[model samples]
Target: MPNITGFLFLLLLLATEGSLGNSKNEVSHGSSQNVVGRPLGNSLNAWKYCQLGWSTYERRCFRFFKTALQWIYAEAECLRYGGNLASVHSANEYAFLKKLIHQGAGSAVKTWIGGHDAVKEGIWLWSDGSYMNFRAWNSGDNQPDNYKKNEHCLEMNHGAVQLWNDSPCYELKPFICVKK
Candidate 1:
């Protein structure tokens, strides 16, 4: 029947398109030969903090800091390895970052996060040029707690459940950096 023939043709076309879509997804996920000409390392290895024993996933690198450093120094270190501190743009990403930090399993300390009110006081922005979407702050956080008026950098105090803290850019603290 001509109708049956046309239906089969349509089904075949749909199957082919599906296969193509899957191939593209695989390539994007770094499971295809499309990366042959690029560097030969897993996403974890390509991360900037691998030298510091941190891991990577899908072009993002993570690091755990036992000590604290100033924001500028932390940012410089991240730049040295082609990365900046981590920023969470979505709930899933926030969960993933929290998991990674939890894996480090160290004492609570204020660590530098990748956001600041640098451009204009009170206008926060991530180093990656993304807008501030979600903020995790503790009580009395971000209130300009009796410091100079020019403190522009942000930190996450683990003791406060990774709440935000604004501090001078030169204060030293251990920070996590992300690379892509």
Candidate 2:
């Protein structure tokens, strides 16, 4: 019943978001009267568009899931939200994602961020079909070494500050999702 109610409310918000300005805060899914957003006149900006549990950055909405899952399952979960795993394109964006993970997980954690070379070795691509222009690979020990010939998916916070390492797609790790 709660899921239905939340879905209806989300639909209503979507239908009226343009006219109602935009929601800027997390929305409660239950019968709480303390809702914050455009309708409640709590928006700090008139154009924010990310929903509850998602953080808006530069017109894109990002969500971090703490539940550990394999890379494929993580991407699938993101796809369920009409998006794919996040793709970091710049140092600032990567820092922002790291901050989001820190806030959500309470520490640095090995998390999935959608860079993979599953199809072709030595060629990485974002799962969202975006170009792979930036990389924060771990320089120590020479990562993405394809240890055991199974490392293909990208993960961050692996033994280095904000650095990434390649891991098997079957390994479980928390993930982040993004959408415009």
What's the true lDDT of residue 134 in model 2? Answer: 89
lDDT of 1 by residue, 1-180 (tens): 999999999999999878965442233334321321122255523322133355554445566655566787777778876778777666666655666666665544567889888888878889867678987655554344425786788777535556667778888777878766
Q: How well does candidate 2 score on lDDT at residue 41? A: 27
Clashes of each: 10, 0
Question: Which residue pairs overlap in candidate 2's backbone?
Answer: none
Model 2 spans > 4 angstroms off: 1-48
Q: Pick the candidate with the highest lDDT.
A: 2
Give TM per candidate. 0.60, 0.75
Score each candidate by Cα lDDT: 0.66, 0.84
Clashes of 2: 0
